[model samples]
Target: MQITPVTPDLAAKSLPVIADAFANAAHSDGHEADLVTALRHSSDYRPEYDAVAVNDEEAVLGHAMLSKAAVVADDGQRWPVYVLAPVAVTPAEQKKGLGTALVMYLETMAYGDGIRALSVLGDPAYYGRFGFVPARPFGITAPYEVADENFMVRELQEGGLTGVHGVLHYDPAFGLTPQA
Candidate 1:
């Protein structure tokens, strides 16, 4: 399987697959696909961080993305960052590591882009495998009240989070509100 950026053609074919995958997810709120769509149109969306997993035939197997976000300190300070949202793998392709591959590819891109750290709100066990840890310990917190385990962050660079502590604010697309 090859992981590649979500080009227009790939996105046209992959969105439905991504929607179905999340629709069937055990923890989905039935709106993850919508979130991806909204993020795609977001000004903060970085196409380079959006990706798809495809087979030898270029059939879409999975989809994932990182979006612009920030860590805001109480003193009115903000540290820009990225947040990994809605990593989806078709149910039929689940357990074959397509999701992991998608995530790894995104992370590799983020690191290359010089991103200091990134956060994700998801299954701790699954994300932990990628070296994610509770954000609280790093002085980072989610804008919403999520479980300590579900809201996690990973430092991509050495001492990336050092002295960078604040509430994580995701792009408005993540809020799931209709864009004005």
Candidate 2:
């Protein structure tokens, strides 16, 4: 399978398949639709931030997204970062390392583009293979309640998350309503 940046037309065409994969993967999770919607609207949803793995026949087998993220600095500046979310592989494609290939490709692309850090709420067991670890080590916290082990970050640059702290602010597309 080849991992490639998703073109606009291909992205649109693959939405239904990606959504179905996400829903099935996230079964019983209250945020599947919200997550899908957020992914569609996020600034990072561009062709550059999204990718798909296609088979020799060019059929999309997996999808991944990396979006804008921020870490608050001691002086109150928001240090730019990236958030990886809702990575999905077709059920039939699971356990074949397609997800790993997709993520590794995206992470390398992100680093080449100057993205220093990446955060995700995902299984550490899977992501740890890619150097992701609990974000708390770098003083990072999720905007919503999440299992500490599930909220993880990886620094692409040396000491990328060093001394970084505060709540991670995702792009507004995450569907979090502000208090009145």
Task: Name the candidate that leads on lDDT.
Answer: 1
**Segments of candidate 1 deviating more than 4 angstroms:** 176-180
TM-score winner among the candidates?
1
16-106, model 1: which lDDT tens digit per residue? 8878898767788898878888899999877888899888898998999999888888897888889898888888888988888888999
lDDT of 2 by residue, 1-180 (tens): 788887766676556656667665643364643565567775556667788888888788888878776886547767788888768787788888888888998898999987889998888899999999999867888878888999999999998877788888887777542200
lDDT of 2 at 142: 81
lDDT (Cα) of model 1: 0.86
In angstroms, give how far residue 174 of model 2 lies from its true place.
1.1
How accurate locally is residue 42 in candidate 1, as Cα lDDT from 0 to 100?
95
TM-score of each: 0.94, 0.87
Give every collision pair in model 1: none
